[model samples]
Target: MDFSGKKVLITGASRGIGKATAMAFAEKGAQVGLNYRNNIDEAKRTLKEMPGKGHQLFQKDIGKTENCKELIQEFIETYGRLDILVNNAGIFQHHKIDEIDFEEWTQTWETTFRTNLYAAAHLSYWASQKMMKSGGGRIVNVSSRGAFRGEPNAPAYGASKAALNAMSQSLAKKLAPHNIFVGVVAPGFTETEMGANALTPEERERLLAETSFKRMAKPEEVAHAILFLASEGAEYCSGAIIDVNGASYLRS
Candidate 1:
């Protein structure tokens, strides 16, 4: 869809899926807000590679609660509107239940939940207010399949995503009255920086075997799905979880 003049605020957009999503939106003629924490250089690199125009950055540690409101306000002030909010910024780690530390556990919980879930919630609330004043809008929460099936070692991360999925559903229900559509893109393992660094050869092969495609997803593949959900064309797709998993978990 042609998204000229549409504004999207994407979190963790310096690399991987977020970067790909931002570029895709830009190429489609949307103004993008590229959010990053510590990698301004990398974010700028991604921006330089983008095909379109009118993208800006707002760097803040979103894991901190205070930065959330600040970033959202900055987004509104910069773009003059918030048509789409992609809650894509997050951190991932593995843990064994017995070896998990209090700081580790709390950081995992706070960071993942705050960045993955709370960011969308705060932005959606404010963005929806803007969209309501102007007519309507969309929200695409970058969730994970881990949310639905859950994870063994990384319980906190899994639970946080699950909470985000639930929040999308609840917000969709509540926001539909004002024409705000909230949906989720729950992807399986993909060939992102985290996936490459975390997965061993044997583990990658094993994970690939889970998919009918026998491979990991490309960043653009998931971005295309997010674009669809975020479009005015998908106005009726509220409260839906679109699993872009290459048939990894297709039901019989």
Candidate 2:
């Protein structure tokens, strides 16, 4: 879809799926605001890689409530208005039940939940308000197949995404009358930097076997799906979770 004149904002956009998604929107003529936490070098590279002009970068940590509020305000001030908000920033740390101590467990849960769920929720709250005034917009949340399939090693991550899906559905129903559409993309085993670093050769084979394609999804593959969900024709798909997991996990 042609996103000419549209403004987009993406979090954790220095690399992987977030980077891919930002580039896709840029290619389609949308001005993108790329947000990153600490990777200034990578974030600059991503901004340079985008095809279009007016693409700016915001280096802010979304885990804090105040940062989330300021981020939306800054993007609006820079771009005038927002058309899409992709909540792609997240953290995935393993907290094994049998090995971690109580303190470690609590830390993992707090960090994961804050970065993965609360940040998205806070951004959505402020972004939706701006979108309402602009007449209409789209919010696409990047979720995970682990939400339904189970993340045995990362229970907090799984739970956070499940909550994200629920929140997306809730907002979808709440925002429809106001012309704002909310949708979700739940991808499995994407070939992102985090995914690559998490798997060994043996683990990779096991993961491949779980899907019919015998391979993991590329970042762009998932990005394309996100773009589709953000399109005007997809307004009816609000609350729908489109799977990009190569049939690795199925939900009825």
lDDT of each: 0.85, 0.95
Q: Which 10 successive residues of model 1 have the least lDDT summed?
A: 243-252
What is the C-alpha lDDT profile of model 2 across 8-124, one tens digit per residue?
Answer: 999999999999999999999999999999999999999888997999999999999899999999999999999999999988888889999999999999999999999999999
Name the lDDT value of residue 25 in candidate 2. 95
Q: Per-candidate RMSD vs. true structure? A: 1.6, 0.8
> lDDT tens string, model 1, 1-252?
888999999998999899999999999999999999988899889888887778998898887777877887898898887888888887677866789878877777777677767776776776777888877788899889888777787787788889888989999999899888999999888779977886779978888999878889999999999999998778788998989888887533
Once superposed on the true structure, which residue ranges of model 2 sit more than 4 Å away at CA? none
Give every collision pair in model 2. Answer: none
Candidate topping TM-score = 2
lDDT of 2 at 202: 94
Q: CA shift at 110, candidate 2, in angstroms?
A: 0.3
